[model samples]
Target: MIFVTIGSIFPFDRMIRAMDDWASAEGRGEEVFAQIGDGSFEPRHMRWVRRLDRGAYAEAMASSRLIVAHAGVGSVVTAGELGKPIVVMPRRAALGEHTSDHQVETVSWLRGKPGLVVADGEADLPECIAAAAAAANAGARLATTADTGLIERLRHFIHG
Candidate 1:
């Protein structure tokens, strides 16, 4: 199963529409569950809900073979912790998806990281999804933990 999420704050119709179109064309027969947040476009090829609760979200992440998500740190971090293969499509400000291009910057930084792939646009999503699925099937694991030193520093900063 593929779990698609666009986070909770904004509507990412472009990503949702692309994924729907891709799924419809691919005929992979994989079950896709999407968490679309206030998006106007309804997915025709995949099952979707307006939002998922925390427990439901966690369950979806844990059960999914691959996670297709927006380039948001929360989703990325959760997917990383779960060792899930994740394909990220960043929301663009120019397309009215976001107030800024932070997602683009986030994707830029996260590319090449283990278990993470960047789909720069709809054109790249199919390939990225295929790669992610293959990697997952090959028993690839994402780097879930930060360096010990960084962790300690963060702890110290929080405690101090």
Candidate 2:
């Protein structure tokens, strides 16, 4: 299943709407499910809930073949730890989706990380999703542990 989530703090209607439209256009509605948050735009093509409980949320992530979500650190980190491929769409402040454009900056910083793909705008979502799904289907996976270099650097920074 393709699990789509907009974190608990804010409503991300644009991302939700884009995914909903993509599901409809691709005829993959049944395969898509969403945790939409407080978004005003209800998904017409796929199943969705306003919010998911912790257990349910974890289950959805665990079972999904691909995860589509807003560019939040928690979601990105969890996806990496779970070895799941994720497509992230940053919430834009210019659209009043957040208090600032930090999400966009976060996406920029996370650009080349394993198992994470960025959808810069609604129009970019479909292609990003497709690429992430294809990679997942091809057995590409994120490492469940931190990179060796990162770990070593942290160790040195802390203990030196």
Candidate 3:
């Protein structure tokens, strides 16, 4: 299964459609699930999650073989924390999917990092999925992450 998320901000039809195409060519029994706005559009291959519990999202994230996303910071941070292998495709401004092109910059940094894989588009999802599956199978270790003085530093900066 491939889990596709565009975060909670805006619609990302391009990423959605790309995953839909990937679902068709990848495997017969494979699943592609996406989170979109209003949830009206439908492609033959993929599934859309219109309204589901956060638990459902968490379950899918934990269980899915490959996690495909639109380069949102929270999602990327969570994936990194979970040590989940991710394939991120940035949301383009011209696509009318986001307020700014920060995702483009964000994905640019994330793609080269460990435990994350960045895909070009839906056309690349299948191959990316295979690579992700191989990585998952390989049992590679992700980085150890932590924030030691985040709150204290923030408070000091604010107060000072």
Candidate 4:
């Protein structure tokens, strides 16, 4: 079971489409599932789940061997905490889901991090998916830039 969730805020239709195509071609007959918010994504081979509760979401993450998602820090942190290898794709601002092109920067930062693979475009997604599909293959790595220290500091500021 290959579980994928694209947070409603991200532009992930392209990535979803590519994954669906690959799943069919590879003939692995894998079950690809996701949540389609904004009613934009037309789920094909991948089953479009209408919604998932928090427990369901966490369970899904736990069950998944490969977690592909947008370059959101929350998702990255959760996946990392669970020790799941994640393939992150940034949502481009030009595509109109974001206020600016910050996700590209986020993806870049994550790409440099260990235990993370950033899939920035459609062309890059299939390979990343394949690499992850291979058991215990972490794929190409650049550097590990994820840090929880900043998050802790931010929490202190918020609570202060």
Instruction: List per-prediction Cα lDDT, in the order shown.
Output: 0.92, 0.89, 0.73, 0.71
Candidate No. with top TM-score: 2
In model 3, which range of ten residues has the least summed lDDT?
Answer: 140-149
Candidate 2 minimal-lDDT segment of 10 residues: 136-145
lDDT of 1 by residue, 1-160 (tens): 8999999999999999999998898836888999999989999899999999999999999999899999999999999899999999999999999999999999888988878889999889999998988887788777887878999999999999
Best by lDDT: 1
Q: Of the candidates numbered 1 and 2, which has the greater TM-score value? A: 2
* Per-prediction TM-score: 0.90, 0.91, 0.80, 0.78
lDDT of candidate 3 at residue 134, scale 0 to 100: 79
| Whole-structure CA lDDT of model 1 | 0.92
Candidate 1 lDDT for residue 98: 96
Give lDDT tens digits, candidate 4, residues 42-88.
Answer: 76677767567889889988888778787777778877777677778
Tens digit per residue, CA lDDT, model 3, 47-125? 8875457898888787776688878877777676677888788877776767788888887766656667777666777
RMSD of each: 2.8, 1.6, 3.8, 4.9
Candidate 4, position 32, lDDT:
69
- Enumerate residue pairs that collide in model 4: 112-143, 113-143, 113-144, 113-145, 114-144
List runs of model 1 lying over 4 Å from the truth. 148-160
Q: Write the per-residue lDDT of candidate 2 for residues 67-138, one digit (tens) a residue.
A: 999999889888987889999999999999999999999999888666788999999988898888788777
Over all chains combined, what TM-score does candidate 1 have? 0.90
